[model samples]
Target: MPMSSKTMNMLEGLVKDSSFKWLLGKQSSFDEEIEEMGRSPSAGTNWIPELSPVANVVVRRCSKILGVSANDLRDSFKQEASESLKQPSLFARNFLEYCCFRALSLSVGVTGHLADKKFRRLTFDMMVVWEVPAVASQALLSVEEDATVSLEAFSRIAPAVPIIADVIICENLFGMLTSSTGGRLQFSVYDKYLCGLERAIKKMRTQSESSLLSGVRPKKEKILEIDGTVTTQPVLEHVGMSTWPGRLILTDHSLYFEALKVVSYDKPKRYDLSEDLKQIVKPELTGPWGTRLFDKAVSYKSISLTSGDGVPGA
Candidate 1:
């Protein structure tokens, strides 16, 4: 049955409620606001907007028109529901899109239903599948017609692609997975400087090879600590503690440090941004020796780099 004029007017008020309006205006896009609900910088962003706190009249009337228990919608399911309800079948996707659009357009008197002719026609022609793009193989995404894949199961096998899955399945049809390896391999702005430092080091090593032929004992070789191709110049160089005062080299891919002295034997400590470099924070400048703080040192310019995740000093 179609909603009465009084009922439609109440629905309009619910959408315009101060709390809901605040949420809608907080972000430039619905996807940004919804996705960052739990993880946004502000502690208050974690607070989910509840339908119950609204005027009781609005809640009762909107709930009755929507044909769902108001109590179910009132709970703090902002994170869980936004995540789980993300990857529903095409039928469910269409149903949700219609509902959201209908609710937003209530002032204009638009109405919809899951059993509508247009929705039913789309559902009939659809193939309910999880199209994951990481493996680039047909087996990765294709879902069998009778197969039922839960959100929990999908979370385990492809934990990295949850955000993408949420966006696509909620909107409709399919989603693509970005290459995690490629994301790591991407270089930063300081790459060119790192590459120059690397070339200079190589040239110095070649010149020193002549000394090895002479009677003079050759210096111990410094080991390469990181794997994968790094193409960048060293924009920042410092001495930091990795068991000793190690030579710290900051480049596009990693923060690398190693002791040049006999104690460490040129074995370097490497912290690759690809592995777990979440955030860099709380930098401090300090001294080379105990209680003797320097404004500038030969290494690091007296600046100490600190990582939020407790990566060794660099």
Candidate 2:
């Protein structure tokens, strides 16, 4: 269902009142599109580190910069990360995909919202093929609605484009103070009824052709299997962290949002969190049931309509 025009207009007004003019200055395409949408534009751009293949080069460089043996670097990275996030090669590759995507999208003037749209489109395409249910944990299984389908529903359908979001939150005070911080990351799989950064990846992937991501939630469940028989495995992990390099994986959106706010606005405490610089945020995945539900709610809202541009989601 399309959001009422009035609601959208109101949102646009909010963006205008507290304008990020700097973001606008950096994103001409973004600005024009918003204008086209009959909305106002912010100036400042939300600058996130680009996830690119070159990052593989960068990680290698980081390894060199840290002055550690190559083998040691890989081992330490894995040792510090969640067992759920142990695939160094895949994590590097996906990070690179994220890098390449922003670079490519930047070339086309699709910064935040536009790029976010691309992510969703790609996620949807993956769902059609993978046949992964739109739900993740038992909480997502529809209760009021029940249905019986045949084995044809179990036909060996193709897999989703091995896409997953491992949302992590950095800035664990205790870890930073004690020089022990790492991501307690959560991974979520997106399908039709399910939605998330996958929506953004789905769109971006269509335009870029990179596999986005897929998978689950807490109690340290690293193994995911449908029907409790066959299963897929966790492959990615935080690759490296030390005293100065700390990490925290977050599955919670509100906390993630708060972290983003604190990092961006609370400058006095920036150094306090700097110990968290080596962090990876699976924000889309990190948090309580409420946070996870918010993520699901976003997906639920996203499925109700087809957006041509922008984060244009519900």
Candidate 3:
């Protein structure tokens, strides 16, 4: 189902609010408001107090989008939260995350919304708020003021692409986030990654359609990760005493290695990943001329192959 503009607008406004006290329907005096601001900068930032009244408006809408009742959704969140020790504030924050994650997961599936700037920004803000979701009244005043998201939050929103189309993986998303933002996820870096992922998915779809039209075997598996450098970080594939530098691509069903032939790449060799093969993939030592001098490669071995192939760390 298409997400309503009103729903998106409401979410956009909700996340943009630095404080959620307004949603509590509480009217405070001028002095109380000033005092609240004078408290720890991180205090009351993570959760909204007295959230039950607003559930009809906020959580209910999200539950509707998910095709679940509001009470059922709340119960499910509580059940999940109960798996770990649950505090009042933590429970509330987790509930909010549950709603936001489910709703965003649905909304992104709508056409042209996955790469929308507002959607990206809203998701990033949700992540930021999720990182510190709890009223920390005694939080240190000297805490860094930098606004950044964390790996935990990134994992929640990043996997949507892979789950939807398998265009990327969690590791690839983390790599992009860390490479650009230096381990701290900023909105700009997050948005750039999403845009790139969208483009890659589109390109892959076009390629699949073209292959089908040309009477070629359509790509049946989704690309999981591609790692290689034409000139710099060469990916080495080792067989016997010989090694060839190439680009490695992993898919849902197999691995493909395209050897670098001077200024171009040779035809890719496919290695199937199947249950019947009894494949064993593990980290092993590899180096020049069959010497096991460096422990920086992954070894792929199966009963069907005489010699296992090793791929350098990606």
- Alpha-carbon lDDT of model 2: 0.27
Task: Please provide, for model 1 over 188-243, each residue's C-alpha lDDT reduced to its tens digit, 9 standing for 90 to 100.
Answer: 21133234444554554443212112222222323223211122321122334322
User: How does each model score on TM-score?
Assistant: 0.20, 0.16, 0.47
Best by TM-score: 3
Of 1 and 3, the candidate ranking higher by TM-score = 3
Q: Name model 1 segments beyond 4 Å from true.
A: 1-243, 263-266, 281-283, 288-292, 296-314
Q: Which candidate model has the greater lDDT, 1 or 3?
A: 3
Candidate 3 lDDT, 1-314, residue by residue in tens: 33345434433443334244345543222213223332424323212333422222344446556887655676677677665535664665667667877887788778777567756655665565555544352131111224577777677655554432233465565766677567887766667767886787665555321222223223577665666744477788888767888777777787777777877777776666855788878888887787887687788777766544434332
Colliding residue pairs in candidate 3: none
From the highest lDDT down, the ranking of the candidates is: 3, 1, 2
List clashing residue pairs in candidate 1. 191-232, 191-233, 192-233, 193-233, 193-234, 194-232, 194-233, 194-234, 195-232, 195-233
Candidate 2 or 1, higher lDDT: 1
Return the lDDT, model 2, position 278.
37
Instruction: Order candidates by TM-score, high to low.
Output: 3, 1, 2
lDDT of all predictions, in order shown?
Answer: 0.31, 0.27, 0.56
